[model samples]
Target: MSKIIQSFEAKELKKRPFIIKIADRLTSFFGSISFLILNLLFFVSWIIFNKFDQFPFPMLTMIVSLEAIFLTIIMLVSQQRQAHIATIREELDMQVNKYSEREITKVLNLLKIIAEKQDIKLDDKELDEMLNELELGYIERKLEEQLSEKQKLIIDLSPLNKS
Candidate 1:
């Protein structure tokens, strides 16, 4: 992979606080199918070995609830860290894309100059049209507008809206 892509991943994984690293590992383990299997086995053993009523397992429920609370905290911490990393990656991508666009524009201008010097009579209508410079702000605004419109449409069509 390119250095830019490698940097995107490397920055997030490296220089992270110790607490965050632990939380990420815990989150990964807790979210896996292995965790589910373990929980199932624990529940089965508890039921088989214990004399408690099966209909309402108070002790098991309490244990599960406590586990869920801790798991949620760890997951949230990891998710927050991941969100931060994603934002950094997005900024990197935008910067790379903007640089690439500028380079492409330069190439196109050079090609146009070459064509002019060659006295090539190109009838392409697109060639006659001027190229629009990549505007990150404009694109972001347009995306936000479109997203808001879609959100509004979804809200209007939602069954919950009828009430």
Candidate 2:
């Protein structure tokens, strides 16, 4: 977990322009409850003052629509950054898992050899099978197929079970 945090911190340290940093901070703040309250207060004050025809405030509606458009753009930019980070994390995790699997296989083989040298009989068929090398490509392909099948089932059922 510490390693993961360090990796994420390192990733965040990459150089970004001042405007982008400001935009990121702004978007992050925009998602908070405080921002919601701020907007609520603004709307209430506007109504109390009769700022633009109390009940059917067309100006307020227009302002909100414009704000929505800009917010959507900001959200898209942030999501793109997040998706890039997710891809990097996924690749890192895959590499670590592959390395760990190889190391485990090496250790298991060494233990088996040591047991044999000591004249110790180890007769676990499952352990012997595990000692064999993993076929990562085949496993990955199978996993992808399973995921696609599950996605298809979800897509097929979603409309019929709509809330």
In the range 40-132, model 1's lDDT, one tens digit per residue, is: 999899988888646588888899899989988999999998898889888877788788888887787788788889998667767544345
In angstroms, the error of model 2 at 83 is 2.0
List pairs with backbone clashes in candidate 2: none
For candidate 2, lDDT tens digit of each residue in 1-163? 5688677857674655576676788889999999999999998988788744667888888889999999999888777776877787788888888888889999999999999999999999999987988899899899999999999899889977677
Residue pairs with colliding backbones in model 1 are none
Off by over 4 Å in 2: 4-8, 158-163
- Against the true structure, candidate 1 reaches a TM-score of 0.86
Worst 10 residues of 2 by lDDT: 9-18
After superposition on all CA atoms, what RMSD does each candidate show versus the true structure? Answer: 2.2, 2.8
- What local lDDT does model 2 show for residue 96? 86
